[model samples]
Target: MASNGSDPHGPDRPVVGLTTYGERAAYGVWDHDTVLLPSTYPDIVFAAGGIPVLLPPRPQAAAAVDRIDALVLSGGPDIDPQRYGADRHPLTGAARAERDAAEIAMLQRALEREIPVLGVCRGLQMLNVALGGTLVQHLPDAVGHNGHNPTPGKFATTMVDLVPGGRVATAVGTTVAVQCHHHQALDRLADGLVVTARAGDGTVEAVELDERPFVVGVQWHPEQDATDIRLMAALLAATRT
Candidate 1:
């Protein structure tokens, strides 16, 4: 690990690069520079003993991977269904084509290199689609129940049951509450990834790769409630290894 900066945790801190969506500034209708993530994501990671590196949207995502130890794909807008062979839903939010392409490229590169990756919410969906998987697009429609109701916006809470003997169970030692704010979820898992958790409605809440190197996805947003500290800790631990 690079000791370019002192570790706040008093050890070799892992460098985890977190990807975020670009938000256009709304100032007098004048276009401003692209803004980074909302900051809660990295704050959680930092509190969990890892250094957070923000990766901006880029076309040369392959080259960007060399700069970090591991990758954390953060939550954002609904992914374009076309990328995963589905028609657009009437409620589908904004879709950034460039970001979609870049993130897909980055995910492919990471898996090819066997690098650790953690995906949350939309990030989870991206991982699934990149690995020959499909998504529900709207949880209410697919799950046949309101999976996102408990948490309608950011900074809310939800429940998840950990799959026994799964990666999340091993990390957290128990199924617990996590924060969520997404309307979409995994319909069919990506290749080589196993479902590790679920909601009461039986919505897929988490998944982990059967192979080596920490690659997992969660439907909840741990960055919001900070209840599932293990989520961030696990990512940091993967980055160090």
Candidate 2:
């Protein structure tokens, strides 16, 4: 059955556009053209009382934002270093030009429309780059430890302190236990973004737009925690108003 991508419960429950990976994905002996996202994304959105729609990473897909109330640029591949006018770091991961172009286009639309957006990990990095920010590229080199992402393919714990009365502070309070798994971080924050939280070692853990109510990004992977959905809840609540 082909889905028109509409949800019956979408009226009261604002629709959120979630970006996905456009790559060859294999699962359960199946292999084909696919756009896939971690279930944690949609699952948290639903738990926060919003309808989640998987958005394929295509520039044309940016038009679909017209039908949704908010956007969430899910975490994935690294952004092209050239996007930020920097040479590649020795440890920089492979760039995904297609995904980068698609999300940046859609993100510009969402911000112009004043739609709520929550970016996580790579999503956060891309957001920064799109708005003229730079990245650290390699965190362990920048910070002297890999605690932010102790394991290559697993979640690690970190304590983040939120700015007083900031968007993240108001939603999830002053301090939080966050799940993180990344080796890149925001170096020079983009214009219009205010740093709202930081890890113990001064890594930028969270940010919110200086002028927008719901545009926020977090370095940590909140969805993987399962206990804290405040960020998702905040975005959902913003759509209601």
Candidate 3:
């Protein structure tokens, strides 16, 4: 096992890399572009027994995978429609081109290396799009309601049922209530990936590539729930194998 220098859990504790958002912000008299993420992400990773490394969107960010044992594609803005051969939707947020490129590259490298990966919200959509899948663009248009994202800046609670005997089920059980805040979802699932969970409204909520050690994507934000570390814990556990 690779030693995580200075990690309190000793050298065997896995190192987990998380993707962050690149956007304009103001901090301490500085108002400019910055790379940042909600503390919840790192907090959950730490609670899961992994050292968190925040990866900014950059040309060489994917290379960081070589130093980490697992990867977490954190939630962010909508992906560029062109990446999946579609026109932009009016409701779809503008694409973060650099973030899209960086995360896709990292995901590719992680999958090739067969490292554990967890995708949240936009991360889930990215997993699908990166692997030849398509998104619904505007989820409300397809689901007939904005229940998935009923408010801005706040996560809504929703119920999802996992497929029996699936990896997701094993980690979080067959039925679970999750925090959701997404306006897009998987439309055409990619090859080698299977739908492992869905919302009561029939919207896809989770997916996984069973062939890999651990490649799970959840439309909800598990990080937001300080109590449930099962998903992240599962990713950390996969790093051991």
Candidate 4:
């Protein structure tokens, strides 16, 4: 029988380590540099019957894989283009070098250990770049519009078509409406990643490394929609094995 995760005597839940943002933040009268992440990320994880652990960017963040059952590369700032051998685009936002280095190390370590991983938004981009993939840098320039990020500080609605029999399809079916807020997307796909989903505008919406038990990256913010948790739930399920 599966434990409900609420009872102390029940089987222990999987520990999910989520990467966070290293930025200057304000809370009350204190305005200083801090490690932060949206509560929605952890909220959805806990709802899916997993223990959530925040992983801040640090020199040795990759060591965290030794203590976690799964990893989530949460959404945040743009990755430095130089990491992938590209010149910065005029429209590209400033990169968080430290965060990029730390997350990449953590991701590589997680992959080496075959730890289940789920990437969201910028997290998706990181997965691609870390695996020798490249990003469009500016979707508006490539797609000729900003529909993927129609508004600032708000999510745009996007309908994605999932490839049949893929991990994403098994979790969320063939078609799904997702919340999107990204200005960049996957360009030259990595060597082993399979395209699992795409937007109506022909944007790459998701990718996965089929060789691994679970390594999925979605260009949408699944955590934003509190009502739906299929993605996070699927990630937690992988941790059990």
Clashes of each: 0, 0, 0, 0
Q: lDDT tens string, model 1, 5-121? A: 445385667777788777877668688768479778888877887778887777575567776777888888888899889988898877888778878878777777777888888
Best by TM-score: 3
Query: Any residue pairs clashing in model 1, and if so which?
Result: none
Better of 3 and 4 by lDDT: 3
Q: In candidate 3, what are the lDDT values of residues 86-142, reduced to their tens digit?
A: 998998898899999999999999998888899999999999999999999999999
Error at 5, model 4, angstroms: 10
The sequence of per-residue lDDT tens digits that candidate 4 reaches over residues 1-241 is 2233544224687889999999898999999999999999889988787788999898497897888989999998789999899999998889899999999999999998888999999999999999999999999988899999999999999999999998889999999989999999999998899999999889999999968989999999999976788888888778766
Q: Candidate 2 residues 1-241, lDDT tens each?
A: 1122344244567888999998887789998888899899989888776788999999999999888988998888778899999999878888878889999999999988888899999888888988999999899998999998788788998999999999889988899888899989999999998999999999999988888878889998878955667888787777755
Q: What are the Cα lDDT values of the candidates? A: 0.78, 0.86, 0.90, 0.89
Task: For candidate 2, give the lDDT of residue 198.
Answer: 96
How much does each candidate deviate from the true structure in C-alpha RMSD?
A: 2.8, 4.0, 2.2, 2.5
- TM-scores, all models, native as reference: 0.89, 0.93, 0.96, 0.95
* RMSD score of candidate 1 (Å): 2.8
